[model samples]
Target: MNQNQSFRQLWISQSIANLGDSFYILAIVTFIYNRTGSAAFAGLFPILRVCAQAISGLAAPLLMDRLRLGTLLWMAEMGQTICFGSMCILYFFLPSQWLIPAVLFLVFAISMLHGWAIPVRNALVPRLVPSHLLVKANSLLATSDQIVLLVGWSLGGILVAEWGVIRVLEITAIMMFFSTLALLFVKDPSANVSAQPESQKRWDRMKEGWITIWGNPILRTLSYMEIISGLGESIWAGSIILVFVKEVLHKGEDWWGFINASNFAGTILGGLLIWKLSKKIENRMLFTMLISSFSIGVLTIAFTYSSNPWFALGVALIMGPPYQARSIAQRTLLQFHTPEVLLPKVFAAFGTILFVTFGFSVLLMGWMADQWGIRFVYMSTAGLYVLSAFLTLMMMKKASRSIQTQKEERYMNKIE
Candidate 1:
């Protein structure tokens, strides 16, 4: 099959897997919460998963080259299936005290697989589609990602409420099993490709991606910007936002819900906007940086000045489009800038850096909010956004000058 057809099939399979993942997580969390009766225990799930994912992301660069992309994708899906099925068995057979640790362990395992799966999937996109289509493809895929998240979160809750957590587990496993089957049809174009010389040490293989990013001026700058953006974007953490609404706005829990919903709605709108304007958006990097910075400034202002919940909702709504647009633009830029052979490693390194920064930022911001105030944390994140923009702006100027200098040298050489 043609690459386009293959990508379409993979996309469908991924969507299914994404949905299944969402359901499985919710089901597991719900089960924990119901059993333990503690939001803290429920919250630990994400933290554990993120920790596992970060470690796995750090390891992905070394693994990606050794394994077939299609094989890894399918294996991830199948692994998840086994994990979920195991969870079901545990729920039925295991004693109550053993459940939490078992659940947490499975969550870590699933997250580890997911960490590698994401970079592999992203690296495959450029291979499947041409350079010209990258923006649109990324936009559509991101949109679908958000939509699947929305559907899964919404439907999973309802399903768990209607049927039991065990039933949800069973359903999630079935979905993952189907996803594995779908992946079987994806032919790995690079399967026949030989690996680098055996003399390449394990440490060297791991460092390859890091070196590639450091060696490329554009990628290096982009990495810096993303690192800052992660810190800034950590304000989106659900718990922090909820606290902000409750303590600062003196609003009810429902207001927190409203703001959260608005934020996600904005994300969905932003993804759609990017998909629609993908072709028309010239200078993707510059436009992304500018829009992102401006939007964060706007969000900061809204949070600082507005005590009205409705105005806060409006601000949340406005925040989604630029955030989604910037994400797509940045992703496209990475794919365009990085060589195809090194793309997997680049993505792995990027994901690792971003995840680690964001995870810590969330903790840091949460503490700052507790000690200082939520408003301070919000403003600080906005400042980081501005700083990142300024830094990227300088990098863009430097790149332009370098390009011009090369062009001038070429012209002079022709005259000689």
Candidate 2:
């Protein structure tokens, strides 16, 4: 098939997967909340699921070769189907806590599949489209994903409330199954690897990935960067609903609709703008710092005491556009620096790193908010973002040197 054809297929597949995710998030959160009737308890469900995902993320990249990308994704769809089924079918007979572990396991399994898919999926796109078009493609993906986020969250719970949690789960599963059909036409690119016998031990395979990042200061730096970003992100996540519904502004459950759609708008716009602006820029790292600082710093103030419902929603819409711009810069750096096959393992490592760092912060932020004033929590979070920005500068310095070294090596190879 032609390059455009290839890209269109991949893009559609990604959109399908994202739409399913939107529905899945809607179904799971709404179902849990209805079953339990407590916000804290509803939140607990995702926490367990995230924990499971975090654990599986560590091993997922190592196991990527267990199947081709097409097959891996197909199996993921199957897992989603089973996961949804377990939720609805088991709910009829199972106890509350039982659903907790079962759904947790299913989500974790889904995450593991995601771990395998992300790097390969990311790596595949550049081959399908020209380099110049990649930013645009990514932006498109980011935008749609967020748009769907708004829709899914708004309707997902209402469906559960009126129909049943089991019905919601079942519908999401069907959505997932339909999404999988989109993958059938996806062009399987060459697996990003050099053919070698399967002799490496799993521990050692994982270790080599670690050692590669550790040995390369730039990759090591990105690792830490991902951790910090993920952590600060978790704070906003864990607190947003509570802060919005109770502390900052109250719109009842409709608050979720506003928050999700607006935040998604920010992300979508960010992605779109990045696509446009990336070619004009050279010092992406510095530009990234400036834009991301705006995002993180703004959150600090926005959550300081809580504002009007409309005001917060407006803030998100304003913020969404820059989200992808900042995100794309980071992704470009990672993609440029790494080769193809190793991308999965590196990303898996990144996921593991993300979960541990962010997971700890989620627990920490939740506890702190419980004990201290939410206003104080906002101030503390602002400080965290500033600290992270400073650390990025430090990491960037070392990364710059590595880039120079790589250029020198490339230049010397030309002479040879």
Q: In candidate 1, what are the lDDT values of residues 258-360, reduced to their tens digit?
A: 8877878888898888777777863555767666776776677677667888888898888888788778888888998888778888898898888899889
> Once superposed on the true structure, which residue ranges of model 1 sit more than 4 Å away at CA?
191-195
Deviation from native of the Cα of residue 34 in model 1, angstroms: 2.2
Off by over 4 Å in 2: 1-3, 30-41, 85-108, 192-197, 238-241, 248-260, 281-286, 302-312, 394-416
| Model 2: number of backbone collisions | 6
Which pairs of residues collide in model 2? 266-320, 266-321, 267-320, 269-321, 270-321, 271-324
- Give the C-alpha miss distance for residue 156 in model 1, angstroms: 1.8
Worst 10 residues of 1 by lDDT: 187-196
* lDDT by residue (tens digit), candidate 2, 22-125: 66776677666766788987777667656766766666655565666556656666666666666677777877778767766676677666555565566666
Which candidate wins on lDDT?
1
TM-score of each prediction: 0.95, 0.83
- Give the Cα RMSD of candidate 2: 3.9
Error of 2 at 35 (Å): 4.4
